[model samples]
Target: MPLVHIDLIEGRNDSQIKGLVEDVTNAIVKNTGAPAEHVHIVLNEMKKDRYSVSGKLKSEEDQ
Candidate 1:
């Protein structure tokens, strides 16, 4: 089994997120010889205000 964890600022639509998981699963299966059914993915969507870089919050950057 292969486990993947992805974290991103919230905003993307459901289809986009689904596509991401599909692509990631394919990549893991190709590289690790894991079955697609055995691949596990966890997505964590954080609010922009909760995620920051270089002392600037992502929500603040949009302003």
Candidate 2:
């Protein structure tokens, strides 16, 4: 089985997230010849406060 893990800030709607997982799974299947059913995808959505850049928290921005 092939496992793909993705982490992103929490904001995207359900459809966008679903598309991401599907796209990744399709790419893995096409390139690695892995079965769709055997592919494992994990999507981790973190709160803005849990992420940061340049020593500043993401939630501090005008998101």
Name the candidate that leads on lDDT. 1
| TM-score for predicted model 1 compared with the true structure | 0.96
In the range 1-63, model 2's lDDT, one tens digit per residue, is 998888999999989998998899999999999899999998889999999999999999966
Q: Write the per-residue lDDT of candidate 1 for residues 1-63, one digit (tens) a residue.
A: 788999999999999998999999999999999999999999999999999999999999889
Q: Which pairs clash in the backbone of model 2? A: none
True-structure Cα RMSD, model 2: 1.0
Ten contiguous residues minimizing lDDT sum, candidate 1: 1-10
Query: How much does each candidate deviate from the true structure in C-alpha RMSD?
Result: 0.6, 1.0
TM-scores of the models, in the order given: 0.96, 0.94
What are the runs in model 1 whose C-alpha is more than 4 Å off?
Answer: none
